[model samples]
Target: MNKYLWRRIKYFILCIAGLLLALLIWGVIEPYYLDREAVVAEIPLLSPSWQGKKIAVVSDFQIGMWMANTRTVAQSIDRIVAERPAAALIAGDFVYKPGDNLTPELDRVIQLVRPLVVAQIPTYAVLGNHDYGAKAVTEASASDIQRADRIQQALEASGIQVLKNEAIVLPNADRTAENDRLYLVGIGAYLPKQSQPQQAIAQVPSSAARFVLMHNPGSFAELPPGTAPIAVAGHTHGGQIRIPFLPEWSWMSFVEERSSWSWISQIRGDIVRVSGWIPGYGNADNRLYINRGIGFSNLPIRFNCRPELTVFTLQAKT
Candidate 1:
């Protein structure tokens, strides 16, 4: 072969070999490293008399992703249990895709999460964009809805209350007519296709000490004035990547109007509410905690940002 042709051939072979090596490394190291991140933040929310009661937050269970393993998720739940939280809040995306396995995977999740519920920790969940994305996999809108409903049902059966833009007052253990300390309000997925936030917050009493749960962080914008003391959300997955000094703009840029990358924002209004991200607790009122989600999305690889299970300790400010 001519020198020119030989050189070209060698370069091409080298390129292919490099690509293969990169893929191999990613396949082996990605799953273990990406899937193995400790639950980062332990937020403290002060109540009048409640001192050390903790609420565990688990979000973005994008099951069925190539990078996410069911075992890892179960382990994460186990960690949450170890924290001995008073309650567990799940912000949506229970399934990666709507498929025959979707229901089964959801069932598996229920079984794994059942112990936590049985432990008497009030578990609450809200749907996410992916849960409703079953239309893409099922091909039929009705089937998608049915599949989502099934997931919800399974969760409820396992003792997790599925909140669809509804408010449920959580009674204190004291049950004393005097100590009405905790209230949990959940909003549905923040899709225009699903329920509306305005309608959801309407159900909650403005004067109550509320913890609002919603799928998308952006939904906080729509909350009625003086709605909640703390809002928990999951969807951004901490941008899925963190570069040194450079922000993860891939998802933030497009979602700027809908969900800004700002993890914490104070909603100035009659009530002066605050909306904070719940994936990894960015720059919000120290009250908002954004969990770095348990499952993977789109690319199936997590860099810098690892999955997290957050535990928030609600204490008395005084």
Candidate 2:
């Protein structure tokens, strides 16, 4: 009887080990397969002049991270341009962990997305926490100011507009510019010293058709309910790895929560009240869509979850 029990225990241990090995392989290779999703948002206060507009949104490019492919992002840009989107929006984190290679990193990042400028897509962007050297494990550093400046300059040079705590008005062609203006508000990075959401919305008119761009979902809390028609973000990277049906048990969640303490929060108890993983759209007055993002942050492995490219079409409510 004792010998039989020992043999059974050995077999069970071996099975667990084999399963773990298979999962590790899946995680390591999954990131290469990029995924695309379509976002259709209905804005009640949308400008009739700007109806049926298509916008492309991407975020968290973390270019310098291990195993993150720049080519993949360029290909995604190709796809976006093919759709002929009116504008492209980058939520933030153009480069990952610049460390001492700030200039080169920024240059490469710009070069990767230059095709958008060439396509005349009028790309707009907002900085993410990583762009300012702020991570889940650490706060923004003093020296990150230089990194942030270089990123902004590179983006501007590429003809991509950078917005921080500001608003811009794009004239609607169908109607006269006087009354039909599209308001785009780019909020600051959701990090210390740079996070100024109130100032970001200060200039936006309540009546103008508005869409808020942010990198962190945490910033979504600042906007008044029902006032913001749509807000897009990408800090969570779609949880980096989403299991089909089992979200709470996703391998990334166990490690991800540790990297960022505030990963769990209560925003009317609707901020991913799931198993704590699986990134998706949430219903609210603002109607937020958090893109899965294109790059990896702390970990290089991704299983079930792939890099995301979101193409959004804005429809005005009748």
lDDT (10s digit) by residue, model 2, range 143-246:
78777877898899779999988989853446665557777889877764576667777788777777788887767667666656777878777667666765
Q: Model 2, stretches more than 4 Å misplaced?
A: 1-12, 136-142, 171-175, 248-263, 270-284
Stretches off by above 4 angstroms in model 1 are 1-47, 134-140, 248-288, 316-318
* Model 1 alpha-carbon miss at residue 163, Å: 0.6
* C-alpha lDDT of candidate 2 relative to the true structure: 0.74
What CA RMSD would you report for each candidate? 6.5, 3.4
**Alpha-carbon TM-score of each model against the true structure:** 0.74, 0.87
Local error of candidate 2 at 111, Å? 1.6
The Cα local distance difference test for each model comes to: 0.64, 0.74
133: Cα error in model 2, Å: 0.8
Q: lDDT, candidate 1, residue 233?
A: 80
Task: Compose the digit string of candidate 1's lDDT tens values, residues 127-202.
Answer: 8877877312123367667777888888888888999888887656744443455667788765435656677767
